[model samples]
Target: MNGLLEDARSLELDRLRHDVHDHPETGLHLPRTQQAVLGALDGLGLELRTGTALTSVVGVVSGARPGPTVLLRADLDALPFPDGPRHACGHDQHAAMLVGAAHLLAARRDRFAGDVLLMFQPGEEGHDGARLMLEEGLLDTTGSRPVAAYALHSSASAPAGQFSNTAGPALAANGTLTVTFHGAGGHGAWPHRARDPIPAVAELVTALSAVPARRFDPFDPVVLTVGSVHAGTRPNIVPAQARIEATLRALSDDTLARLAAVAERIAHGIGAAHDLEVRAEYTAGYPATVNDGAEADLVGAAVADLFGAERFLRGGRPALVSDDIGRVLAEIPGVMTGLGACPPGRDPATAPGNHAPDAAFDDSVLPDGAALLAEVALRRLAAADPAAG
Candidate 1:
């Protein structure tokens, strides 16, 4: 490890990682997590701003000289599980790595010109905290918008230390769907006497499962998972309303729109056939996380230089996984890369996937992840510096 990565190693990220991991919070408000971040960055002397609508921390680091501004982000919210909220997605690690980067960069503030915006955001798990931060004028923290922005994520299924990202469409576009069928309630024994919504919703579920294969081209893949379904309380009585909730994902916006439209039509058609009124609400979530080609090439070159050629992944298409950072990239040119942090002794192929209860992230990658973030900012700042020429 070089000087920067070595310093990241000594930062002792476990204390903060464990503390936040042990007591994880979700949604827009993460008071305890926010406090932990403030405590870590206490003596750093960076100008900081906290979110009014959310528990977001935006720290501005102005270098000794003036140039352009670069932004780095980390999502701090944990995924909610059946047992309890957990850091199964490795967000805790992301937080630690960014903290390490902040310390490392602060120690050598004279090396880089311009400013660095440290974005510690919440509600990344199906919540658009990035959008929230942008709404609150995150880009306006400095006098001008960031010339370039960067953020990295941890992957439990990839070999540790490897960095992977694509130039275009690194992550998929997504939306959340909720369909409710309203009907008159009656005794189950006399189903013919009244309109029952249970049958409509139940039929819609099966029909939706077949939508991708039947309606969409097999080449352009679409994933629609109906994770939640609800209906009447009593089995003997027909419920007045039945609802089903689903998550939608597509590589392109047009595909996602078509998928949503098909779902709504099928749901309404099923409800009408059953003599019920249907309310299909498809709230569009995050957009496609498209990366700038030059910015992405910079990430690959940095990884290859810092580690080795093998460290930078070659080719991979966008996946169904969605991230709120898409909101930031939409407004500014940026790249969201992925770092493999899967723990040792577990095969990346067979290890439990991210968000799994047993998913684990190796703390050893903290230094590398942190170093890469700092390196990205420095490179952007140097490129923007006229004196560097």
Candidate 2:
């Protein structure tokens, strides 16, 4: 274990992070990122497989001895925004950390048992790549289901090198909605001759915004924000069609369903009142990320050992953010923790959050992330075997 950590220390972790940060790819189109990961895993004793339903890659490393198969995952996709094209969500760091962990494990293959599945998934922002891979037979192709899985994210809120996890519902479920309003078009100078969609769209936006502020408890962490709306091509003429698009997030499946129903009803009512035809579409995205209790405990112990017990925080309520990795957690017993990537002395509120244009992560946490990940994988693999314990 010590030797693996030493190898991680010399792996140029920060340099790899910068290389990924400089060139960020959105969703399943991460060609350069895919190539880099494929190259990094070369020559390792693991059985490697690439090209799984759009740039998603999976590597399987089996130990000489028999034990439970554990899965470790990292997201390979980035956000669609220009600002996020850089190091916005710390995905570059995520890829580097996972690669480092895989290398560390391969370096010390004699210390553990069972197989470790390294999954680098894409399109986590919205495309549900993890679910797609599963539907394409990832679980079946891998033979037996993974006994446990583990994942982690870089946080700009906490100080560098700190680790945190929650026992239940670490992240929320996400849903996408789109509303289009159709109305009659007439001459601008004609009065009462045309049914206007602009008013309906305006009212719909206001109503959707009020859902979070008025309907749900603010402390409960629910979000319903309208990302885009388009109406009327010219100032003098009211267009016949108007479109509205939004993203909804909630901690539970019930909350998500209610939110969708509310949106549709509200949109329909507004359209009726405005004498316009309304069409709304809602699609369920990723489910909440819930960590397994036992696996979470194992990860906590490994984190505490590497960064002292004081730096480990295991009790936290779920956030409203959605993760594709949550799908992996649902199938396997596992936990996903947050690493403190926020620079020292910086207020997290003021720091750029994920998907923001100026979002950034502390580079000093690279080695710590690599080490913590390696330790978690080793500890989990060891614990799965009663004889090793």
Candidate 3:
């Protein structure tokens, strides 16, 4: 049999997955992980290049017949922790699947009619590694802009072997809100003696939370989570400044922009009313992971074709989590689909989410994910061909 199914059943994938997972590295500089990927891809005959700014790997597999290009991306970083880094997000699984795809695609290059750009990216966890790759000329690697780009993100929330995603906004655009109010410190005995920034911070937090309900439409969602609040050290002593850190997520950039503006306005207004200086810093994160409508349909059709209709699940709503893959999709026409990788036996509905210390993934999804991605690349390339006989 072919390497596609062979890799699926092959024990080597498990070994590779464990190799990467056991030695998880964080941020844009994952030398060990990059080396592991290189080892897995050695002697594959694909033209390879490492990133200038980060530890990214890009390989291209050209088909026998000349055609347009397609991109398949897999991130190569993990979540950082006090104890060290962890592959809690199943990026190791993602890497292994893409490697399997590389093998399968390379083995049968004459069957298709285009170049497959394999993008192994790093620092997907808020570092914007995809953006760095784009800046370093990701689309220019194959000499032709990809007709379509596709990526599979493993989800602990979904059952193993099931694929799920929504068209339009599949993932949220991530942003941050920081409001620091400057006030004069004073003793706890008298409130009028000092400007209490804590009260203003509290008000701004409430106001920012209400921005989504008032400014944004109910049909479109905007999530505002106040993650941290800092103020005085003691209960009795007033602080000179108080700050609130919040994370903002929206399905669209316009909504995120609107939310940021409204939140900043309310923050300054509350500070002004309190007669305190307010600094509202709004930082934009990754943009929304918008899936091309036709591409999304193609993904569902592909999953159904490969794994049967039971394997594909169309999500009713977009996920609020932000993804750097959105950076690539924003530049090219593509789709980002989530594959369920919850380890066997555990309830998928209750599986610990990615980034959690105890999160787990089943290795069996590696071959299936690889085969599915290869099939998608093949299908998209065939459809993109206008001169089909």
Candidate 4:
């Protein structure tokens, strides 16, 4: 609202957010989303670099003096919900913020002394877009691999304008599990003849919970939730096969490994006890996003510049959520800060999460977000090499 931002960029941001909300594309294959971001970066008068591992867009903004480069990123993908194209996770807002930052920096290009790598990455919603970008050398071979990088995620658990950032493990590591139980099909009348898998499936569901609760350490939180179950054709006939899908979360790698072992044990035990053949597959997904202590402190200081320290608190140790940004941090030392964009005047216990169909974002602090991102980029650019200017 103050410093370098202007009215034109703000208007453009509104349009961009609405446009993305109206036409939401799910995950990695976001053509329209990529195009929209491309247009925004192009309009900002930056050199656009496209086709970085399927729809990932990168733009470079050069400063007046020569110095180390910094990367500013925003994800450009939506959920695959049948319930209309909604910006459930407020990614539209993230795109708008990055676009706004690009505009702000471009408007006052002489203030800084380094290069800015503005990335509009696609497929962050469980598609591993960050991994894809990294695989294609998005960060590597680039100018210093970024002396520092920054990205913002809008949070619905807190109020608007008030920001909260975690210094350590901010998000959880997740793994997707798919288990199928197979058995002989027969009529329900003859229980002894039919090798029904229904009981095994039920037992598996109940047994999975024990892994994270009783077997694993109580202090180390890990969760195994069965989100979907499919089986049986009719009530009279016993089903030959059953499928169960679950999402697993853990704060630490050892916990994740232990839970995985426990899951396999439970599946085997249930299948043996119920006389059914069970196959369980655990696919390792996103890892826990661990923030660098120093980088997180720097981010907190930057946030304090916009909103005073009294309103902010360093986030908790970690939570049971996963982010593809973890892949980036694993490759390089960086931090992913959570922004309190949750609607005001509601308790977090009742607030909807990122992927919820009815999730909506409060736009009051969007400009503030834009300003914060711009300030982070400017501050990093200046601090990395003040002698350049």
Instruction: Sort the predicted structures by lDDT, highest score first.
Output: 1, 3, 2, 4
Per-prediction backbone clash count: 0, 0, 0, 1
Cα RMSD to native, each candidate? 1.8, 2.1, 1.5, 2.3
- Residue-level lDDT tens digits of model 3 in 1-389: 23455555563677888999999988999999999988898988999999999999999989888899999999989898888889999899999989888888888888888899999999999999999999999999988999899999998867889898788998999899899999999999888999999888888888877888887888899998899999999989989999999999999999899888888888889999999998999999999999998888888998887779999988657889999999999999899989988887789788899988889998878888998888888888888777654
Pairs clashing within candidate 4? 172-321
Model 4 spans > 4 angstroms off: 5-12, 344-349, 386-389
Task: Write one digit per residue (lDDT tens) for candidate 2, span 1-389.
Answer: 47656778888878777777777788776888888888878888777776656787788877768777778888877666643455578888898899888888887777788778888888877788888877876665457678888888998776677788988888999899999998998767873898888888999998899998888877666889999998877778867889999999987778888889989999999999998898999999998888888878887888776768988888977788888888887887788899888876678767767777766788878777778777877787787788786
Error of 2 at 6 (Å): 3.1
Task: Go through the candidates in order and give each one's C-alpha lDDT.
Answer: 0.90, 0.82, 0.89, 0.79
Error of 4 at 60 (Å): 1.2
Clashing residue pairs in candidate 3 are: none
Off by over 4 Å in 3: 1-3, 386-388
- The TM-score measured for candidate 3 stands at 0.97
- Please report the TM-score between candidate 4 and the true structure: 0.93
TM-score of 2: 0.93
| Candidate 1 accuracy as lDDT | 0.90
* Tens-digit lDDT string for candidate 1 (1-389): 23787787789987888888988999999999999999999999999989999999999888889878999999999998888888999899889889988998898788878999999999999778998999999998998899988999999888999899888877889998999999999999998887999888879999999998998997788999999999989879988899999999987788999999999999989989998998999999889888999999888888888888899985577778899898899889999998998789999999998988899988788889989998888888988899977
Q: Write the per-residue lDDT of candidate 4 for residues 1-389, one digit (tens) a residue.
A: 24644443355577788888788887777898888887776766786777645787877888887777788888878777665556788788899888888888787678777788887888888889888887877775345678777888887766677776777677888998899999999999996898989988988888887777678777778889999999998999998999999998887666787788788888888888888888989999888888888778877787776667865578665778788888877766677877777776666668887778767677776777777788778877877775844
Q: For each candidate, what TM-score against the reference?
A: 0.95, 0.93, 0.97, 0.93
